[model samples]
Target chain A: MSNDNIIYPSVHSFSNLSLSDSSRTGFGYNPYKGPSSNAITPETSNILINKKTVSLTPTSFDSIYDRNILKKVPEISLSSFSFLFCEIVNWTRNNSKGIQDLEQRLNTLGYQIGQRFLELVKTRERIKYSKREIKILEILQFIHGAFWKSIFGKTANELEKSQDIENEYMIIDDIPLVSKFISVPKDYGNLSCSAFTAGIIEGALDSACFPATVTAHSVPKEGLPLRTVFLIKFDESLYTRENLRFN
Target chain B: MTLHSFYIFDRHCRCVYSREYTQGSDGGSTNRSNESDTAKLMFGMLYSLKNIASKLGDKEARNNLKSLSTGKFRLHLFETATGLRFVIVSDPAIDNLQSVLWELYSNYYVRNVAQNALSPVDFACDELLANPKFVSETDRFLSSLPVFR
Candidate 1:
């Protein structure tokens, strides 16, 4: 796993490899005559396939907006998604020894997703790059509204601070999409399937350098049944820093 | 044509919610016990049927069994990815109950029950049933259906 951190060569890096005369195949194609700068020129973009190299012009590719991101968001069938989630929960349950272990496993899975998703969302919104979230509240609001909307198709219902606790915060989702179809059996005690969502939030926060613990808690209401509250507790050091920097 | 009842079950085959719309008054405490027992039996049967259906085909390809008819009533089943099951019992000849189920799942279940932050893991089924807005909206939708008239 440690070796996985080593950066591998990109296709663009192949240009440097062919620069050396000894490594070159001497196939009449002059590797040195092209623009020597790092910018992607027509000559440098040529990719090698087998023994043959195909030169691709910049026009061969479509615009990034047209090819990569869609104008309209894609929709997923909710029923199909629910069944798949059910199986995931069941599979995790079978492999885990207890409810806590099962939750930890789910959290681990969601954590990886959260890390990747944060980067993707950040890059997609690069045009709006003004400042990184330095203030604690600013980042929490970003996660509560923008991040939640991007993933779940809606903003979280509520964001509030605990009346008594200084560092404690809460983000409430009227209905958590991940646990939409989940029904924990009575034997599981107080297991909230939204624990997976909590993990995702924790992962994103940790990646953003705000280190916190997030947990999902069920808070049943009169009409809304599957409502969940995600409790976020920041590290003591974060509070100390926030006071020193802001106050 | 009359809509009889609706049942909601979790993955564990426990009946989380049950409602009767058109049953005649058999006024007694025994009716409550009987209704509970019937709910248990109904869930057990559905569980077995799901198992049998999966065994009949490739396990991965076997989606939830959608509906079944017993000549007198038709049971329409909707299963979510997380294994929550919604079962509606109605007249045997009713058409477009699938749409009704979809409306119930999306408009009612997702909006009222699932979205309520105060809803517990058990789903606060009784609270959902008692909510006036939920009840009225559902009643309006059902009455608007041509079959209900």
Candidate 2:
């Protein structure tokens, strides 16, 4: 992070021939890059509350911003992240009024992650002269490809505009990573843990200035039990503004 | 080369952690408090300066305030996405300690404090980074650096 000359490592390197083959090539995926720089959270606010500064001393802590923004963080294990997510869900559930409130809280938690993730991933893209996503479809595709890949290590399975609804879109994941180990209890009726991922999508979209409401739903296929669909609903005025500005 | 001190601040502009490498004769309670006050003042100054610095650029000098220096010492600053700031005070002749500060943050700071589930996550507004392991490891790590002493 010190010097611009510092060479940042790239992802998906061919090294350390693991006995267990990872891909069809029979080689493990060894990225020269480090782990997720965003291992730590919980301090993030869903809303950008104006913090009245000028008091209190800094304790020894860090966040994934500034110099560390493009720096590849040590990868956070899925199990560990799941554990933390479980705890987050459990904690939010305590204060939630109902299933909706619980999901909302979970989404709130993912929102900040989304906002930060967008900037960090975009910077990491390091396109030399890449521009921001101005068009609606362009931004959505960016999210479905790069944004999802950065967070989940893979792109969303499908990015489809809603056939019935004008402003609605859907991003499908055959096997959602977050909810892989989680099972909603029988008593909880229809609680989906992917609300957190939905929140992340919403946060990233909103942060990118694409302002949308994203929610997660369980859409089971024949074999994929944990199949989740993220429903993204854009604001009514965005289409009008896009028409006026771009069209 | 001499590493004078180090400071960490969150987005709220609160100093989350600070350490001074005072050796021998530089000892006194009043001086210590004064040093802390100096840190607070330094934060305010840097915070405002960052805003100003971001604007003083044409096409690209913006948003890239890396270091500040005077005859006495050079201050290296690093900020994170979540708005955490890491500052290091070292000899003016030293090239830069931005890497060192980043190491401290990712290695000791994150592992010891931020990732520790039992420890407070919000080291910005609500909590202070008073973890014993974090402090001690940081002291060990900083003192061992070639720039120290």
Candidate 3:
């Protein structure tokens, strides 16, 4: 068995079955449907018999709404957060094998947070006509706009499609929020703390079914020394699939 | 209020960045010689002054020496928690440049020197910062300010 799809029995009503139905066999009952369409298979009497062993906690089945989900994000001290992030970088640096490995570790740390943040952002954003972003351009725009603002309090500086490559794009940010206070040592060659932010973009895209690889590069401008370019490379199969469906 | 020069000293009291706008600024754009010697003397003077200024105040509190002034020019000092010092030399008539130095630290130095992986955290003796991007950026930022001549 592949174990691809395992459907568990719905525990709706244990007290509804009578004591006479002990001779049941292939057991399946969905209470939502009418009695006319019910399978009425002779199920094992074990589930029907009220053993009174399992007690459903008040938080378990019925009350599924998360009260904190809709709550607004509270203000946090910037200095405290900066210090915390600085400590994390310092700690990670102590154990990392090399510059690239250190960046990779930082990116991995931010990946899960980005995945969850995307879902939460999407939930809170679209109140009325909520829809999943399937189109590539639409989702990228959404990320560049509301998603960026929600996290950094500002939208990305620039979003550009690569002229040379078919499935490459770039998002530029002047002074990424995470590495705002970070100063890399001279020995750590070309290691940007914004790798974490790149991972966030990657995680968000992957979770949204875009499936892209993302990396951050420090590309300083005349005045914008902290300017970083997040290069996103979409998987080849996505382009093929999009071409088939949308084109 | 003419901005004459800017200096950055690492925690070890070594001058890492020095930019003199008016050629020589010891007597309001009027003296030039050994650059490294001048930087050392400046750093030594500031180090002692900082110690004296902080000693006169409540000992427990981290009291920072804000500025020192003379008839010709003034030196405004801003030190980060990490012990990196930023000192700017300008006309004595100028007002408190604490906020200006803070802007330099946050918006300029931290962004360029700190964030640049290729930039060395530790400077070699007598070695000055040579990043063109950082140099141009600091110049661009200062030139736009009203005090910069």
Candidate 4:
């Protein structure tokens, strides 16, 4: 029953508090002194692809066979977060360049929250297992299980290591709550801020000093169509370590 | 007159500028529930501030407040459309006040400076007051600030 080796932090205890309580405490670190004078900027960073900034290719697969994975779990309503997210989307749309720009804006916003949440959650776990996640698989597994469960109250659908790719993995979530009530407008095209959630995963992973590239892809599994697969592509340095260990 | 007064008691941390200002009816108990909740959060902060200021002593505490601003210090509290705003100033620069006011309004607290030019929240004498709750709260907060001690 105990998966103590996992690197992600536990957020199950916050379950007792109401959503209102969570809202009051949302990303607001109220210290007696005051809010931090430092403001975090998310736009400065680049999304590295092939060790260089490049446009994401939706058709690219981490692994072909892994796409068939199935997950069995009942859906849950996270109404409070849904409302909060709607406002976040509304805010991002305020000065957005277009649909893609808006999605990027939302992704940037979520990135900081993700980085902060990981630090806070990791501190809660026991010291022996609480060390920062270093490897690609360990970090992906942490995101698929603990991070998803903490944020959405359920673990993700599946975590698969790509067979052909040197350092790639897929995290599938059957229902991303933000996408539940949302159908992107035609003008917006294929843009999705669930990609923001992927950015969060990347931010947390990178901040913990585990460098990786992450992007969100819409892959609806049978019977449940809102499935989102977060593809995490780790850098070559990661593979070098794995190879060294095996050799 | 030296105007030195100190009173020690526990449970809540509050000091009245004039003892007569301390009166509040325990009547119509429904309102008491709302007041009590606000008091619970505010009192802890006030108590901690008292504990901090007491350790600094009157001279050091007054100097600390004075250092924040160059002009005369005034304890100002404003009742906004929602919640309250508290500011302590010995001197006011238009720029400082503007930035603070901007932050206040943006934070959704509409500042209402009443005709009397006084705040709803009580502020005590800058002159030496030995009151234990006040001293304790002040001491508690000031000790934490490296700038003070």
Using lDDT, give the best candidate's number: 3
Which lDDT tens digits does candidate 3 get at residues A1-247?
A: 2222222333322223333332132344432232422343344344444223343357855465655677789989876777667667777877798888888888887777778889889888878318888788888888888888888889999899999989999999997898666655556678888998998888888777677888999999999878999999988867876898788
Model 4: per-residue Cα lDDT over B1-149, one tens digit each: 01111121122233222111111352111112222444345445544554566666775533211112325432222223333333322224222333333343343221221111112223343321223333333334323433221
Model 1 chain A: worst 10 consecutive residues (lDDT sum): A6-15
2 or 3, which is superior by lDDT?
3
- Please give the CA lDDT of all the candidate structures: 0.70, 0.73, 0.75, 0.49
What DockQ number belongs to candidate 1?
A: 0.06
When summed lDDT is taken over every stretch of 10 residues in candidate 1 chain B, the lowest stretch is B26-35
Looking at model 1, residue A149 earns an lDDT score of 83
Residues B8-124, model 3: lDDT tens digits:
888877777777775344323211222568778988998998889788889899888889999999999999999999988889989899999999999877667665544556777
Better of 3 and 4 by TM-score: 3
Place model 2 in a CAPRI quality band.
incorrect
Model 1 spans > 4 angstroms off: A1-73, B1-149
User: Model 2, chain A: how large is the TM-score?
Assistant: 0.73
After superposition, the stretches of candidate 3 with alpha carbons farther than 4 Å from their true spots are A1-67, A77-83, A86-94, A126-129, A157-164, A172-192, A218-228, A239-247, B1-149
lDDT of 2 at A23: 36
Indicate the worst ten consecutive residues by lDDT in candidate 4 chain B. B1-10
The DockQ for candidate 3, computed on C-alphas, is: 0.17
Say which candidate scores most in DockQ.
3
- Model 2 deviation from native, Cα RMSD in Å: 25.4
lDDT of candidate 2 at residue A157, scale 0 to 100: 98
Per model, how many backbone clashes are there? 17, 22, 3, 22
